[model samples]
Target: MRPRSRHRVDELLRELATWEPKELRELQAALGGLQTALERESSKTARQPSPGHIEEKYIQRGNKRHGPYLYLRYWEAGKLRSKYLGKKPE
Candidate 1:
């Protein structure tokens, strides 16, 4: 959290300390539900896959054109790599 948000949370907790026991219990239950929802959202996004990009490559062959080959390009291990999808029919 940012420094400002942390300060706000700190101030809120101080205020909570002065609340009645029944109110504190209600706040605890509400916080538990909020925490569960946030965790579920976090995990859902963590499982989604990124499809970097699609690229095409072209080549010249014996006075004829051979290209527009397709590839899936992405970054891995701090390096850029490509996975061949397919090539145009000869």
Candidate 2:
């Protein structure tokens, strides 16, 4: 089977960018497949964290409710470490 193209997945991100305040469920559904792909990529063991964990952090950063925090994943000592991810709102 052919791999899915990033362009196709990018549609969801675009949709999310303009996503309505009230259509979160629909937005999530649109992005769900992309989200899963990101998770899978992040989990590759060469020196990365699990995809699920990475997705969690990405979602955290994307959330307006979180406001002040930024999120990141990094490799160190053969482990995927999640730090403060982002700062708390003042």
Q: Each prediction's TM-score against the native?
A: 0.44, 0.23
Q: State the lDDT at 74 in candidate 2.
A: 45
Give a tens-digit lDDT track for model 1, residues 18-65: 999887865555454444444554666553334244567988888988
* Cα-based lDDT at residue 38, candidate 2: 57
- Candidate 2 segments exceeding 4 Å error: 1-4, 27-90
Error of 2 at 36 (Å): 13
Q: Whole-model lDDT for model 1 versus the true structure?
A: 0.63
RMSD of 2: 14.1
> What tens-digit string does per-residue lDDT give for candidate 2 at 9-86?
677678777867656654343344346445666665454323323323223545444445544444434444443445
